[model samples]
Target: MSDIDPGQARPPRRVRVDLPGRAYDILIGAGLVDAAGSILAERLPDARLAIVTDETVAALHLDRLTASLDAAGIAHAVVTVPPGETSKSFRQLEHVVDAILAGRFERGDAVLAFGGGVVGDLAGFAAAIVRRGMRFVQMPTTLLAQVDSSVGGKTGINSPRGKNLVGAFHQPDLVLADTSVLDTLVPREFAAGYAEVVKYGLIDRPEFFDWLEWKRAPIFAGGPERAEAIAASCEAKAAVVIADEREAGERALLNLGHTFGHAIEAAVAFDPARLVHGEAVSIGMAQAHRFSARLGLCPGQDATRVEAHLKAAGLPTRLSEVPGAAIAREVLMAGIAQDKKVKRGRLTFILTRGIGRSFIAADVDAAQIDEFLAEELAG
Candidate 1:
């Protein structure tokens, strides 16, 4: 929990993910990209680097990062991919792995993920398999990556079967979250990321959720609240990763909205313009709460409060809000069936008793879900 004062200048924050033999630090601050050369030079003195980024981010921030590396005399090579969810495919993964091999980077060297979630997942997965396992670093540039994906070690590309089905649990050696870079994001992108920020609160931090409600405007305005939000999110995610790095237990709680969200994403074939990850999550979370209430597992008002807050933050919170053709019930249900959380042909979902009271419900009834989604679609 961060106690940053709104009126004071905030210092950089560090959240450590302390695994038994694989501990790493998440450094959150402004201008970290400009300082990356010295940072890498000090920590990984002898390791050459492979910088993997997307074109959009390459255009926006790659030169500054390269210059920083050059100044520190750290040897490096760059690999660029197209920007967007489509890049997280087997084809692109092969392309990146080949590029890394072309650089002749060794197992002891590092691969730096230099964009949003797509680049981080693609690059980290490449690092996991390259030379049997290279060191990985996350330099997340988007609000979503900075707060969630970059910290958790859940790296993977989407399968045609599902989102994030083909990947690995390769944690990064370090995560450099440059809040300054978020200034380059479009408003819609920022709002999408904010959905993940709102997630930490809904997943067991009612006090934090309360704080977000009070400070939403300041956070959106890029005040001290923004850094505090990022810091708090990293801290929240780090705590979960430390407890269950492989997502074998409590870690599943972090996917509070992902089961339904991934389904919606798969339904659209992961089109960003139709629906991005965070927006799908916003809708999924709202649906999760509404379903919880319908099942008498949570108070209806709690679900209402969650939806209202997310809507106020400029996020879409309903299936109807999703653009394009109506996502058929069968498509969404099939996506849910393919979710990684399913085990032994049984379903598992993170349901809530109220705000900050999420619990994993294994063996959830599929028929009930079908009925609930039907009502959701009709409304």
Candidate 2:
């Protein structure tokens, strides 16, 4: 990571995602929602837009989003879905597709996904299939969506078998992240999204991780600088996404905690009835750290530190408390076997060498994995 002078802190900044015809810019800051029209005006001129959001976000931010569209004079319609993970399903995707068709959405009409990962995934999946593919923009409202799911173009729906088991690589035309949206998230949800933000540092940027460890308080303060930090995290993610838009190889690195996380979600029955994606990812990251240490890929001390930070942030770090630990492990292994990363019947686990270093582990035996998970369950 390079350093920008403090003098440039307040300057408007942009990170570009390169993907041939699908390339886009991610704009991160406060008041970005107000600038949505202008941003779209520049990038998506002459496009009819459909704003897809959930009931919760529609209440909190719809007026402003509509106002922005009004300001930009972008002809658009607002489609609201019921809030929660259930919205990411074939039923919901079909409903959105029908709505888009009814709205006469053309191939170039932009679908603006304006909520968390669920909304983005569901709407993006619909965009992928609707009329054979329409353009879309990502307006991630939650921290988790902003840092991880929304940028990579890996859009999909969860099936009874697993999470994100059905989807496509439909990248957004642009990503608009207004950090002000973080204000509407409850504390726990906010903490959950922050977990993914910390992940960027854990996966490859030790210096950024150090900054997070030190500035955790200010980052959560919802200030302009916090918006900058969020933007920086998106910048890191956008760079990785530009290189691998389809999770072919290096892009799978983004799944650092998700392999275990998705399994936990599946085990819990994809319950917005109880478990949240970020919560599951927190516990999964801890489990990954423990498993990595057990495999000697990372020092035990690193796992201990990760545990401390997660716990301090109110993220659950173990499986024992969640009931059915063995079932969770079994289901998680099943998901890993089906993970897009598997090759020739072998799984590729992205284990850490320490806080800032990670590598592919293609030969970690199942027995060792089971033992490590068993210990996590017991601990």
The CA lDDT of each predicted structure is 0.90, 0.79
> For residue 215, what is the lDDT in candidate 1?
98
* Candidate 2 ranges with C-alpha deviation above 4 Å: 1-12, 321-340
Q: What C-alpha lDDT, on a 0 to 100 scale, does residue 204 get in candidate 2?
A: 87
TM-score for candidate 1, please give it.
Answer: 0.93
- In order of appearance, the predictions have TM-scores of 0.93, 0.90
Deviation (Å) of 313 in candidate 2 = 1.9
* Worst lDDT 10-window in candidate 2: 1-10
Task: Quote the lDDT for 216 in model 2.
Answer: 82
Q: Write the per-residue lDDT of candidate 1 for residues 1-379, one digit (tens) a residue.
A: 1112334335568888888888888888777888788889998989999999999999998988998999899999999999888899999999999999999999999999999999999999999999889999999999999998877788889887556779888989998988878889998999999999999999989999999999999888877688889989888888887888877799999999999999998898778889988999999999999999999999999999999999999999999999898989999999999898999889999999999888999979999999999999999
- Candidate 1 residues lying further than 4 Å off, grouped into runs, are 1-10
Q: Compare the candidates by lDDT and give the number of the best one.
A: 1
